[model samples]
Target: MYKNSIKILGAYGTKAKGFGTTSFMLNRHTVIDAGNLLDALAEDSLHIENIYLTHSHLDHISDIAYIIDNYFCKRSKTLNIIGLPQTIQALKEHFLNDIIWPDFSKIPLENSDVIAVKYSELYLNEEYHLDKQTTLTPVRTDHTVPSCGYIYKVNNAGVLITADTFSLENIINTVNNDMQIKSLVVECSFSSNMQTLAEVSKHLTPKLLFQALKKLKRDDITLYINHIKPSCLEEISTEIEAFRGNFKPIILKDGDFITF
Candidate 1:
């Protein structure tokens, strides 16, 4: 059961033959992103009540439409889509616009009073408690768009999740300032040779990733890598091993669990 641990529903940067995109199940009802919810949880996905988005990128939101499409009739509650103000605007104006996908925020659920989806704009750096024990704080991140990652704290320990960031400036400062952070989910989406592409896309290659991590003051934190573009997985993995310096990172897979 993933009652205490954060379950990685999808891990890769983009879809491949077998891999899915970004999604993390924090508990039965709370999730981080909507990249692969339907495929990962199937009918169990119906239990998901809130989807906290990092950004409005397609790879991170592909399943938001499918989850509603598949379970609209069975859903007993509204799907609360939470994110930064800009993130919510993108979802509403572009992603869930009637042409792209049905604006579920306006559509009521079958035989229910609640709408199919509800979008909540979260303030960056404010701590929101999912329950008495779990608190999620959205922090700024460097991406092509206005994106932000989260600091998930439970039982006083936390994990910093950098969903699709290019620069580690904001993340490093947050981690150093917060005593609760014990681990990190950093994305390395390209290989060292693809530096130009990585920067342009606001992603990271192993060389850039590790070079930035050197500034982190806390050396005891466990590093977990995710969001790797499948095509360059092998090359990036090899580069991570070569340049990781002192932090031996565990490369995350779709079914992985991150226990804080």
Candidate 2:
């Protein structure tokens, strides 16, 4: 069997040095989030057909504005925006409304097909089929807003992306319950010193993240860390390196790809 690789279109914690925000273009056409995607992809941005959003945060949904405007002429089909009900409602009421941005769902394409930005509600822990060989399940997480972590299965390999979570119980249970889960991408958004702000913002500092991971039973998972705040990259990296555990977390930078 051929291994499917995941490409990182944008992975910086912040938009420093002309780098975009945290957006992952999975397997070319499918995107997990849209932060900086329009800035990252430029003219070829019309190829994206599906976006599985984790939440309604600005950093996660910012590029939806540009993608609709810049590629409306080139898009041949509807762009499916898949997420939870709250996520969909939030985007519709706040971001994609005509006041903030044009309602692309009603806009007509050249071929008479309207630009479709429809929402599909994903239930907790239930696996939804994306294609013949790919499935994704949404696991609820403790964020300031309604958020979820994704369990993406492709070609028999499972990768869990804990998107902007602060809860330990959900993470522990998901890790212990899913045996097929081989790789993980978790967020550590702040240093240990920023614990108060991190908790208030419902984000995870290195201290909080490690304490949460202590509940997990797995000892043999390839852990990848992401979402480190740009201001605290130095402190966060040092804190993460000092972590003593069975699995050492790998921090991701801009344009890093992973194959498992």
Candidate 3:
């Protein structure tokens, strides 16, 4: 009877007029990334209690500043910003150091002793309980910066989200070892024509994605593709369509919801 749901707030690798960058809300309290969160959640953004960041990239952590600033006075509780040690350090030093954006972690909220923000550092492969039925485990990912993907388990059912990775070896092995993983949300940021850029940026092209998927032993799991660049969406879509594999990959849109 354990239920879990994920709403895709933003699925693109880059933002445009109609497209947004990577962000997903797990149930109502927890969000997987911060990109486009403000735009997608609007006033409902105040409901977010925790943000589990995948990396220190701007596209993944941009909304952290806005959310704290916008809801500064109204917030009753502190917002928990969870991520790896390096990721947290990067955010503190570069993004929210009071030079670029105010460090809300040190600033107190209106008429309260509670601070506006709090930082929690998570270790790789360690399981953190989200609720009585849900837990999140961070696994390593191949990215330009220090990054990792998350495996969210709700009772016996689980979903693996590969956040902006170039290699799939670690994720495939994680899936093979963990029996609970029943779904995957992977990223494909470029078309096959831009394979060089994909490699340099440590993101996946459609061809690269297929090559990685071929290594996955499970066939019953749902494969959800996301983080596509808007300019190359058409080309990536065509390439993904041409890729005939055991599991058909579904390109996730901003508002798509999946339950498990």
TM-score-best of 2 and 3: 3
lDDT of candidate model 3 versus the reference: 0.90
Report, for every candidate in turn, its global Cα lDDT versus the true structure: 0.92, 0.79, 0.90
The residue pairs found clashing in candidate 3 are: none
Question: Model 3, 125: alpha-carbon shift in Å?
Answer: 0.4
* Tens-digit per-residue lDDT, 1-260, candidate 3: 12577889999998899887899898677899999888998988988989999999998988888998988888878899999999999999999999999988898889578988999999999999988988999999999999999999888699999999999999999998877998999999988988999999999988888877787887778889999999999999999988846668889989888676
**How should the candidates be ordered by TM-score, best one leading?**
1, 3, 2
Over 4 Å off, model 1? none
- The clash count of every prediction, one per candidate, is 0, 0, 0
Residue 181, candidate 3: Cα error in Å is 0.5
* Model 1: ten consecutive residues of lowest lDDT: 1-10
Q: Model 3 Cα displacement at 253 (Å)?
A: 0.5
Q: Residues 18-75, candidate 1, lDDT per residue (tens digit)? A: 7989999998998999888887898899999999999999999889999988898899
Over 1-260, each residue of candidate 2 has an lDDT whose tens digit, in order, gives 13355666666556666666677777557888887787677776888888988999987888888887777777787888989889999988998889999887677777546655766677788888778888888888889999988888886688888878788588778879888888888888888888888889888887788877888788878888887777788888889877735667888876677666
Which regions of candidate 3 deviate over 4 angstroms? none
Q: Which residue runs does candidate 2 get wrong by more than 4 Å?
A: 1-3
Best by lDDT: 1
